[model samples]
Target: MHILVVDDESVIREGLARILEGDSFTVDAAKNGHAAIELLQQKQFDLIITDLKMPGMSGFEVLNAVKILQPDTPVIMITGFATVETAVEAMKNGTVDYIVKPFTPEQILEKVHLALEQKKSTVEDIVVKKEIDCHHGFDEFVGESREMQKVYRRIIQVAATDSTVLITGESGTGKEVAARAIHKHSSRRDQPFVAVDCTALAENLLESELFGHVKGSFTGAMQTKMGLLMVADGGTLFLDEVSNISLSTQAKLLRVLQERQVTPIGGTQPVSFNIHLVAATNRSLKAMVAEGKFREDLFFRLNIIPLELPPLRERKGDIPLLIRHFMNKFVEEVGKDVRGISPDAMHFLENYSYPGNVRELVNTIERAVVLCEGDVIQKENLELGEAAEVCSTGFDGFVPTNAEALKEMKRHIRDRSVENVEKAFVIQALKRNNWNISRAAEETGMLRPNFQTMLKRLGISVKDYFGR
Candidate 1:
């Protein structure tokens, strides 16, 4: 840990530095707040301990400067003239802890440890400073893949401005989740987050929903209605599935983006708006534009910040980590005693192709957590795809011509279908007999030898059903 100790008194600053450095912490001492600010501008520190009463810049001023320099860095305020109001003010200014001078070394070290614990690094190795202020949002996402890292960096870049963001990804890839992250990290997080699914409403009603209508504007317009744009004023407006929006509505949306004004249906005056627009889509807006389905002008406006979430299949290495996260979450949410999953089950889940991506994986884990009877989830507890449907885990060196691939595809489908049926039959039989192979074979009217043979062929073993 790197610590910066700032004090007008040379003895206190040097003594604190010696104590921290004695414990193997990297220490730097600043004579005053101005010198401390100069050091902060030069480099980063994990924690800052500043005297409340300094020669030039007070500790409160130092705290504010530190916030602008490194918002993640924790600050500890110390002084001999500590009062109740000063302590309260210290905490209100983002100081991790306040301490009166003439204290023991243990108290200083303890506060320093706690302050350093709160520093969450957004990037490793390289230190970065930016003017945009944002906090909290990326914790929900659980992955360290290169693509996800890039996504995090992109969100940080666009969150500072009011630029329109367009998130493109497949179903269940967490497009809305990404949008929420951007909003939470943006300056408009404290305000409302209004999400409008462009495909959720009829063409006529969509405009009314986006722009407020005066009393008796349409047949069903019983009273004045405040549109989502007005509701999201001084906040963020997320438009989901923008590719499915009607062209007429798209044109009105374009005007809203350009003019920052909305004219409700059957209304006279245009209502001005100040909102950050974030749009998401599962379909390719670019492709729709080429085909003359989506408006080209609106596409450019919404595409100012484009973020694409990768499918689970492409990032298979992250499956195990995601599974563990879901398992821990479901364990707490469902009040289950499950602590872990069997290696066989974990391996099976890791290898299975997730066609529905992260959303599908979450549902799969939720089901498994609900069905799990023991402390560890087994392979039998999981049913990844529909009816155990199988797909290629990867193209392992086998390449077929387009004309010749149909037969192979059919063969795979038929083989998987048959295997699914057989697996289901054996699983039902075992479940009925409490997973006893001999009795399960008897109940199924099959010889024990044949039953055990099928079990071995299907990679099913007694250890999977019961404790090994």
Candidate 2:
């Protein structure tokens, strides 16, 4: 651990530094807040201990600067005279710990340890941050693969801006999830996030759905209804499958986006809406523009921040995370005790190209969970697609295609470990049995302790399985 110690008293600084160093911690000393800030800018420290009152710059100034510059780093406040008001103010300024004069070495070390642990836990939780539990979060969108990480980074960068975003991807590559992610991370997150599927309704209905219509605007328009755009004012309006909207509706949408006002059909005046527009489509808007099916100007308007989500095949490294997620989801959905997928089943999943991307994989896991009977989900339960031919063997020497070689390599890696697959199965089984270890073990043909061992091996505990 790296620590920064700031104190005007040379003895106090040296004492703390020596104690922390004895605990195998790298320590940096600063005579005051200015020196601390200089050191901070030069190097990253896990923890910072500073005197409350300092020369040049007060500790409060340092705390505020750290909050902006390095919010993740924990700060501990130390002072010779401790007051309730000062301590409260220190905490409010984001001090992780407070130390009084004449403190023991163990006391300082203990606070440092606790502060580091808290920071770590907080960071870890942010890694798995969720938007609203529809499973869209920074963590839920899985992929360490460069392509997916690039998408994530781009989303983070663009979410802070108010520019309209047009997301284009193949069907089921999580366009909606990406849209939700952008909305969740944006400044408009506090307001309603309304989604409208352009293809789900007719042209006339879509027009009214976007812009509120009068009571007698058309047939069956019995009541004056507020459209999605008006309802989502000051928030986000997600138009999914946006390319499916007719040219007439596209023109109307373009007008609203360009003018920042929605005029209801049969209404004389336009209703102004302060909204962020995020449109997504499985169809290529550029191609549609070239085909003259979609307006070119509208395409350019919505494409201010273009984000494309790669298909599952391109980010197959995320398959395991997605599989684990779906397994947890299915166990809750089906109320089953099935442990997880078998080795062969996992190989099939890893090698098979998911044309429907994450959506198809989710469905496959759900189905497998429902069909699985034993403690462990076997190959028979998977009901998965055909494994892409990994190795094409002719009579003698065969030249392997690139696609085949890649598939073979993935299959070999997946086949090397059934341990992960088994844990997923066990989690499913525990969920099915309502997290009863004995029942889960009985259902999976493993002993109680052995099942616990598996849980430990999988980095899961019974309390977690049972939601304790």
Scored by TM-score, the top model is 1
Model 1: residue 102 alpha-carbon error in angstroms? 22
| Deviation from native of the Cα of residue 147 in model 1, angstroms | 1.9
lDDT per model, in order? Answer: 0.81, 0.79
Off by over 4 Å in 1: 1-137, 384-388, 392-468
The superposed Cα distance between candidate 1 and the true structure at residue 112, in angstroms, equals: 15
- Candidate 2 residues 12-109, lDDT tens each? 89999899999999999999888888988999989999888877888888899888778899999886664646966789769977988779999988
Query: What TM-score, computed on C-alpha atoms, does each candidate reach?
Result: 0.61, 0.60
Evaluated at residue 324, the lDDT of candidate 1 is 73
Q: Clashing residue pairs in candidate 1, if any?
A: none
> In model 2, which range of ten residues has the least summed lDDT?
388-397
> Taking the tens digit of each residue's C-alpha lDDT, what string does model 1 give over 302-381?
99988999877556556766887789899999999997888668656755656678888899899999999999888888
